[model samples]
Target: MTSPSQILLVFPVGECGGAESVFMAIARHLDRSRFEPAAWFLRTGPLVEEVRTLGVNVFLHPITRLSDPVNFWRTVKAGRRLIIDAHIRLVLSSLGYGHLYGGIAAHQAGVDAVWWQHGIASPMNLIDQLAVSIPAKMIITSSRVAARAHVEVFGMNGIRLEVIHPGVEIAPDHPDRVASRQVVLDELGIQPGKVVIAAISRLQPGKGQDIFIRSASSALRRYPQVMFLLVGSEMFGMDRGYELRLKRLAVDLGIEDKIVFTGFRRDVPRLLEAIDIFVHPATAPESFGLSVVEAMAAGKPVIVTDVGGPRETVIDGQTGLIVQPNNEQQLSEAIETLLANAQLREQLGRSARDYAGAHFSQRTMIEKVEAALHSVLEADTATKAQRHEEGR
Candidate 1:
């Protein structure tokens, strides 16, 4: 058997967010015969255990601030040691601290590094910019729009930015929609026979769950059978206090009984099966739309804001509908349209399942990642060979 190359995945946080899940999926699907993956984390969270389940070594070196020299240097030094001792050939980093330490450590160990960009137009600090300039070999973004944003940030004269759409798991067999709907509705105290429309995302300011509530209220008046499920968790409940604001708005709108808040969930596929329509009303541009694609994978007709990554994922009319963001009237109309017409919903939902399965399978994502890594390694080798020839 050929020896596997060790790749170090340095994650900044342990949160089970979109970017983190993509990286974990990469690790899980990476060809073990040719590549071995391990991970290093800045702090621990629910995802740490999940990453460990991939049979990869994971280390946590937490730091509160960029200026924390003790932890920062200690972690960097540790990264160097890890690179050397574990024979790490490449490192992939996400987030601020991960880029800082992972880039520095890769340079220290004389290995290749790739930066994974997740946030949309979220500017990097001077220090992170410097780290990318010096040590990072490439950047991986989930969408072409995101790639363009990073290129502008990086001042792209010759920067290599690869747009790799994160993959989703296509369920082998569709979940039992009737049973799932019954269970989820019963648990959330949503009376049976009510139409379920859900926004499955983190409860953050940019996510626009508050906006969703406004539209849902409008839709509720038009179609009283509609109930909204807000399925997500607040990161320490700190979305500019948006969740509380949403509750207040719901009560004021007199649609409090029509809403259910299920904080953070593991049964995403089941939840997707349960919901009749998937709505993502992001007020801000998203770097990528994982949930939107995942919903499509679940064979659910989706509605997304006509901005950012969803533009790339959903074919507007073929798979799902796209409405202008923050427009309550438009959002409500889209919701009502889907709820009113079962034929349209079924047509879109079936196309969505086929599209997701063909385009976003987990194996395809893994292969793309592996190819990108190999390209960098091969380029490095060619450069070294050229340098040696010149010296001779």
Candidate 2:
């Protein structure tokens, strides 16, 4: 029997974020029979262990300060050696640093390098852009918006760009959803008949949690039964006093009683089920809204900023309402509209679920990734044959 192709997946951070989550999914769901998967991470954390549980090998290589000439050449030499020693037939990098360090190693080792750019957060510095121009087999973008950014800004070919929208899974029980809602509400001391409005993302400035709170303050004046949920925490527990800032704002707004901050809960699926409405009001352009899709999968009506990948995910009048990004008044009005019309909410919720299931499923993402791998492999084979013919 032929051995499976060993593929090295390089992602610097071994932590859960939007990009990391998608990388984890790819490692977990890759066609195991044909591909042997392993990962390289800079540091170990929750995400590293999670990948290990998926039966993928994880290696730690602290790649530091590549801008300095000595560090750059030393790391590149080490990366090249690592790829060769591991017998890595295909090399894939997620995020900026990984693309620079990992792609360098793969290029020198005579292997095809694939780059996955999930969002704008992984800004391409001089080193990163140098790596991109240097010879990549494929550049996988997570959204259409990202694909355009790469082409217009970085001058990449559309033919080489592969866009795979992010995906999430839905829990399969309605009764359990009701029970979960009750459990969460009880824990929060929220009374029955309170409408839950949740903004589910890391407590960061760009995520627009502050925007949500400001909108919720206005929303509370009109709808007193509303309860706002802020459902995430910053990485490394380094919130940069953002949480304190939010609390202070909440107190000043006089809607402190209406808000609930559940910092980093493992029960996201349960919370999504319990939440009445999902709001993703990103102050900046969101590459793709994973939380928004997860909420839609839970059969909740969503209101997302109309500026980025989130806009593409939702059909404004059908799946969810699209309001301008960073506009508190527009956001509040959208939320209030959902609150007042039960029939509209239900209709949008159902449509959102159907759209999410069909368009953004784990299976759909896995299949697209599988196809990309085969394309790269086939292209490599054809290129080698062409070289042999030219020599003759």
Candidate 1 global lDDT = 0.85
| Model 2 ranges with Cα > 4 A deviation | 64-75, 121-131, 157-159, 236-239, 389-392
Q: CA shift at 385, candidate 1, in angstroms?
A: 3.6
Model 1 lDDT per residue over 1-392, tens place: 66888899988888877888888887888888878999988777888888888799988766666777787788889889988999998999875457788988999999988888776654645654655565677878889898877767766646587888898999876346687679977888878887789999989878889889999988887788888899998873255567788889999999898899898898888788778899999989897899999999988999999879999899988999999988988999999999889999999999999999998887788889999988988898799999999999
1-392 in candidate 2: lDDT tens per residue? 87788888887776677778788888988888888889887656788888988988888766555557777677678778878998988888886667887887888999988988776533445655666666688988878987787777777554488898878875465656677788978988888778899998888888888989999999888898889999988875556899889999999999888899998877788788778899998987777888889889888999999767897799999999999988999999999999999899889999999999999998898899888987897798799999999999
Which candidate comes out best when scored by TM-score?
Answer: 1
Q: TM per model?
A: 0.94, 0.93
Ten contiguous residues minimizing lDDT sum, candidate 2: 120-129
RMSD, every candidate, angstroms: 2.0, 2.3
Give the Å error, residue 275, model 1: 0.5
Scored by lDDT, the top model is 1
Candidate 1: segments with Cα more than 4 A from true spot: 122-131, 236-240, 388-392
Candidate 2: TM-score?
0.93
Backbone Cα, N, C clashes tallied per candidate: 0, 0
What's model 1's lDDT at 163? 84
